[model samples]
Target: MSAYYDLYETPSPKGREGKKSLHARVCPIKTYTQDEFIKHVAAFQLLPKNQIAGALTAIIDDLCDLLADGYTVEMGDLGFFSTSLKCLQETDDENDKIRAESVTFQNVHLRVSSKFRKRIKHAMKFERVHSLTRKQKKITSTVEERKKRLVSFLKIDICITRKEYIRLTGLTPYEAMKELNDFISQGVLRRRGAGRSVVYVAGENLKVE
Candidate 1:
């Protein structure tokens, strides 16, 4: 069944080659842009166009205003939403006062109720795809670099038998397995297959590693 996935599976070396696509929805993460928000609202239960637009605009505005005012807006069963302080300033007054000087949005904290999340996930299956921007790509690269470095220090080069890689990397078998798999997807490492026959080997040297 189709559902949102955060992490996509890396190609598995072990094959029932052509048996199934290696990709799996491990975890799904997404950030909505203005256009996406509009499309999402448009998909809501049939409401007059004006009313739907107004309602969505109001909700977004409310969230923005609440965050600007330093209030954590809670969406009941959905989740807690808030802005993070980018910087704080101390008041010279006798009272120790620290005020948020600037704010930055991290990510929306969402905990959709099981029922709602499931419904949304299923409904979103046929939605059109979206691509990440260059800036996002850079940020992702930086994070992956860090992960690779961690993997390297942990000595997670591929070509090693899975068992041996896990033993040396100090990662639980699953984690070591994941790192090696990611490296494969990113073209940093290569994998041979699944289970005991799986082989991992470093594809290249990255600074992080």
Candidate 2:
């Protein structure tokens, strides 16, 4: 299937004041689940799904630990994994004080190998789709509705990632993350892993009573 995209306008940079420029962004229509990935790998490697899943889990656990320890993991032609950092706030003018305590990791960074980039770059096909306003996409469900849907999903699924929650609830990234953190705080969900390896599972208050 062709990758779908939509166009949006952004203000032109610096000197081009008041001018707008158009840019294209992907419009994903579907999300593949972990089940699909496991099935594909199992078939390709002639392994049982359960075995593949178990190994995958262990690999992820190790990746999280290794990345936390500040190791750059090289995964052959796929990519290398490392951490990235950013300041909480910029220095006043490079003369202002900015200590180590004021800096924090933004997330884990994956630098895809040349082979990996070439594979996708050669295979991608694009088609334009209608664009929706950011506000329109971000305001799909009410707070209660999102909470209900999430609880119901966790009843059948094992866990959810922030991306999955955003897709399920049509929430903006910031809004979805805030609500997820709030749910964790309220004991409705619990976070697993750190940085890029994070996921959420049902907590003591999963029933939301």
Per-model CA lDDT versus the true structure: 0.53, 0.78
- Write the residue-wise lDDT of candidate 1 on 16-66 in tens digits: 465444343433233456655565455554445567668778998999888
**Can you give the lDDT of residue 157 in candidate 1?**
41
Q: What lDDT tens digits, residue by residue, belong to model 2 across residues 1-209?
A: 35657789876776777657799998764445788679767766789999988988998899999998889999789899999888998756877888889888789889999999999999887766564455444375687888899988887777899879978987655556668877876888887765467889989987732
Q: Which candidate number would show the highest lDDT if scored against the true structure?
A: 2
Q: Which parts of model 2 have CA positions greater than 4 angstroms off?
A: 14-19, 43-47, 85-106, 132-209
Candidate No. with top TM-score: 2
Among all windows of 10 consecutive residues in model 2, the one with the lowest summed lDDT is: 129-138
Each prediction's TM-score versus the true structure: 0.34, 0.50
